[model samples]
Target chain A: MKTDRTPKIGFGIRKIILALVIPFIIVLIWLYATMYTSIPHGILPTIPEVGQTFVEMLKSGQMKEDILISISRVLKGYLISAVLGIFFGSLIGMYQPVKELLVPIITVIRQIPMIAWIPLIVLWCGIGETSKVVIIVLVAFFQILVNTQSGIESTPKGYIEVAKLYKLSRWKTFTKVYLPHAVPQILVGLRLGLGGSWMAVVAAELIAATSGIGYRMSSARSNMQSDVVIVCMIVVGIVGVLMDKGIGVIFAALTPWRKVENENRKEE
Target chain B: MKEAKDEIRENDNSYIINVEHLNKQFIVDKQPMEVLHDINLKIKKGEFITIVGHSGCGKSTLLKIMCGLVDYEDGIVERNGHAVVGPGPKCGMVFQDHRLLPWLKIKDNVGFGLKNLPKQEREEKVRKHLEMVGLKGFENSYPSQLSGGMSQRAAIARGLANNPTILLLDEPFGALDALTRIQMQKEILRIQEEEKTTMVMVTHDIDEAIYLGDRIVVMSARPGEIKEIIEVDKAESRKRSGAGFAAYKKRIYDYFFEDSDVEYDVEYVI
Candidate 1:
């Protein structure tokens, strides 16, 4: 079985480079077109202008303040939703009565997008931090809830039977068997929730925020400073990727067994 | 012959598990479907009993019922004279798929049932059982890192680590390749002899039933019932190809296919 399929270090590096090649080409095209074309700077800023604005924002400390505020809001909202979602999701998944009573209501509520509730939420919470956080929570809650419930539900019956045979206590079974089985799915939900939180926070900021990456973009748009808008967009995209990669690292740590399977698939 | 076996069981106080008039039914498509009927079995202490039958014969259900993983509407299942109400530590079960937790290391998987024990004692038992199952060095490995046979071995170790009075196996080797299945058969036999643990296993393989079981319980399908119980009446080192073994296989085959029109293809080039 130990054949030529073992991936070489150089090969892996080449694959990484190959993945970046297309993005590199796209950026190159954007730079060439903006620099060479007759398009106005107000409509489409050059790459150097966006880069200059990014550095200036970083040095001025205004960008840092906005990023910190947005991150704190996202964290507050995401953490609340994650805790509540997993807690209630596990209960609904494990108990039939809870599921029957709440699933229909949850399904109906999930159908209403987070943005749709912004008006009502702002009216209730008065366009404050509370309203923004609530919006982010609504966005993050459904994905985590659904994924956590499905993860718990889809735990292999065989493992449950083994737990039964050993006469494991309910708590023991949940922690040792069900929780471990659901980790991968739960992580997936968290990643998705994180993404939703970013989107929701940005939308909330665009509508009413005093300071955030989204608010910065909104102000720049009205002021026709496209360089600042582009800079904010780049920051948002990079931050989202970084957050996702952070979750990926945690997931790999929790599920080392899956890493081996993934490597085998790569070999195949 | 059945009466004689019952008499022997009545005379001895060594029976660890007893089932009488066990009946089970399932609701399928809003219709009641009987799965097991009038199933009677007695497994003595330290005895190895293998129940063999066709698919849908309710043999696996029977094992589940014994392990208290399934409930039967009517029947008396007694473990050491006490009625089985639910799953308890007295019975450990091994499933067809080596259901070792993928997130747990082999040692942790084996020690799963020993949660009530002290950490040191549980670790000792886990190590001993892992060594017995020929998985000494693979303790730290995850189930995904192990091969199918190795994972199954870890599962058996987990079953045995609990030190249950009886171990119930549901087609434990059914998923293995032929050679690994044979090896696992020998491994189980050795474990059974060493531990002297009572074992009741369900299998579809007739040869495996004869090879490992002290008494082979043949079940019939379509509302499964015990058709016959044949005592191997041979030493532990009995030969598979010997005439005595062939005679037992013939008897079981006759009990299963005697009334059916199934033709046997005995001629082979090799």
Candidate 2:
């Protein structure tokens, strides 16, 4: 009799294959459609043309410079936003008076779109990297702030009561009990905020940038170089995926309980 | 009991806790809701005492008061001849829920109350406690990964890791299913035998009280107070099928069922 399967192939690898299958099929269809169909070449850039364009951009060194500039701005903006968001969010979450005072203000500010802030940001910081960074920071800060506040507020009463029972120092309570309880929610907020900031940064750069990927896209649009624009868009998408994956990895590492549960479920 | 107190006073170091006329009340919507009223109890060193009552009998509140988690309206709780102020390293509590920090490993959760100890010493203490609790191999497992019984074991291990003078357990077995609860009880008995630490556990389950406790304090509901404290001398002889166990269970059940509002009190004991 043949031996049963070892079950050692791993579900994660299978999941990756499952995820890629449809996308790969779609790309194949696109290539075949380009080869056989009468659709205008201008409207549907062939797969190889897009690939060639991607390689060209990589060789020019222009893509690297643009990517670096965009990334640097995003880093600064995201860092500032993360610090401010956690600080204010915790403040509002902790004290009732502060929450009452600030909740309405935050609710109002959260409603305003990042694009709407463009004119005001331009007026205040001028149409430089500063304004783009400001836009990114503003977009990210509110999302994280709101999320952090909610996270802190939603911690179980049991945990806090336990902490109090132990007479844990205030700092220890915050670091050990409250922070750990609120981490998953805070991370969700951060992930959402990261995506929001990326979108806002690109928009801000497109409208007023002299350098970066957004600047390249704008310049490409002006010259009617749709291929370059598409290339830039793909880069943006790839970077977004990578950044999200990076955050996800960190989140999984931080919460091993979740990882174990997921692994168990997959086995089941 | 009076003579036992006199002997304890003569050798003050033997008694771990002395409670005198303890009372606690809460103001709920301007009404003075009394919880524990005119309570007096004493816990000897290296003894296991269980408090059994209905849900509203304030057994948990009494445990909290003893641990200094809540303030009493009147009376005094003394530990080692010193009036209780707040919770100290000498008293560790296990709640109905495990309350293990989800982010921490089993070892870290067990070691949480040992923040003041040196790192190596804390690790050793944690490992020793885990081994005693029969969770030696699962030190890195998270609370979420463990079964309900396992989690409670971890919580028990955490309580012991501090090397506390007393372990205050409030319905620690309540969350487990029947088989698991029985297994946990056996494990706790083994640990109690090994550690020889004082334990005061609160439960609504009479058979559990009889099985695990040297003395079971039966409590009355609403403005809660101790009705009677029964000493189970032949606890090992009082098995589930034994006549002694049945008699004690019936007595406690009849006392609670006297109110008529609690219909299943007798059924719960069986």
Candidate 3:
């Protein structure tokens, strides 16, 4: 058995090495261009210079504070949108009257982009944390609502018959049948919403924030500190990837049935 | 009709289910189409009845109406002297697709119908039924993890877990392969004998109808109506290859081909 598994393990490792090769090559080219060539200092900083700036930001605790503020904003906005989206989406999905009443209005509002709302939100709530958070909320809310509605509407007819035959109550049907069926789609919406929240936070901070990664990048741009800007960009990309992976883990944990379903399909 | 009434009245306690003057219609493309016309059926306690017809014969719809999952225009369906207004705990149904919730484990799926019971009692009943279906060790497995046959078994377990008086099955083995279908037939027979639950099943397979049902209800398409009801006397020891079984098969075959618009050419090549 041990000998039989060796080729599979070797194949996985080889694939990982292949995936990393392109990024490694690009980094090498970047290092050569910045260190050896005369590309001017302000245009593009060397990798080590950016790395040094990152270390200094960490030591001074400024990066930590900005990151915390941005993350807290995302959390608050995302939580509110997720709760309301699921609640109202389910109502609209299950009831035709509710859908007819609210869908058109929500669709009209959703057509207006999150960035467009920044001006009005800033005017209403001022250039404070409320405006930035509201912008993020608007960015995240629509995706969750649409996904949740579709997910609920697309529940299998067979499952609905089961619910009817068992005479499940309305609440029980929602909790047991509809909720579990919609979970994967809801998670998809959540992942998309998180990415949107990150982008919106940066935009909001750039427009009207006292302190955040977006503010730091904008300030660095004004001061001609390209290294600081690069450092902030790297930090944001890393955090975004980590958050996505974290949600992926939760998705796998919640939907254990999907694993067996994919395996059955493969066998077929 | 008078004979049926007398029979029902004579053994009021013996009949577990009684259906009379059942008429069902559906609106298709703004046209009113009658599916079942003035149908009547009487099922005794612990009886196994199979309704066999071709596709679009409305046999499934009839079963659904009996299970209270569909509404009928004119009918009186009674179970143990009480009218069946809607679905309740007394009747359990196993669907054609083995509609087990994909998110739930096998144990929870089986125990789903028994949610009104106490926690300990529900778990015990689920365990017993799961063991009955030969799925003792698969309690934690999801429906997707099981084979088609295994999933059908789980569905049967779920239907019986409530210990209902009557179990309605709508082509439960229709999707299974031939071998698995035969095995499921025998498994259902064994379960019916052990539990003594009345079963009303719909199937398009004649052999399945003859092999399992105490009475085979043969129906015709185009506003589906019962053509005949054949009684199987030797339900205890049925032999598919026996001469009696051949006779029954020929009788059912004639009903479909004798007066129907369908034509057959004996010498036609494949």
* Number of the predicted model whose lDDT against the real structure is largest: 3
- Model 2 chain A: weakest 10-residue lDDT segment is A1-10
How much lDDT does candidate 2 score?
A: 0.85
lDDT of 3 by residue, A37-100 (tens): 9997687988888889999999999999999999999899989988988888888878899999
Q: After superposition, how far is residue A59 of candidate 2 from its true place, in Å?
A: 2.5
Off by over 4 Å in 2: A1-52, A265-268, B1-15, B29-31, B235-237, B259-270
lDDT per residue for candidate 3 within B1-270, as digits (tens), equals 547645755876778988888888999999999899778888888989999999898999998888889888798888877887888788999988999999999999999888768888988998999999999999899998899999999999999988899999999999999999999999999999999999999999888898999899999987889989888766432787777877777778787777742442231111
Give the DockQ-based CAPRI class for model 3: high
Chain A (alone) TM-scores for all candidate structures: 0.91, 0.87, 0.91
Cα deviation at A21, candidate 1, in Å, is 5.3
What's the distance in Å from true for residue B18, model 1? 1.4
Local lDDT at B218 for model 3: 95
DockQ of each: 0.72, 0.50, 0.81
Worst 10 residues of 1 chain A by lDDT: A1-10
Ranking of models by DockQ: 3, 1, 2
Model 2 has a DockQ score of 0.50
Clashing pairs for model 1 are: none
Give the residue spans of candidate 1 off by over 4 A.
Answer: A1-38, A264-268, B1-8, B259-262, B265-270
**Model 1 accuracy (lDDT, Cα):** 0.87
Residue B30 of candidate 1: its Cα lDDT? 98
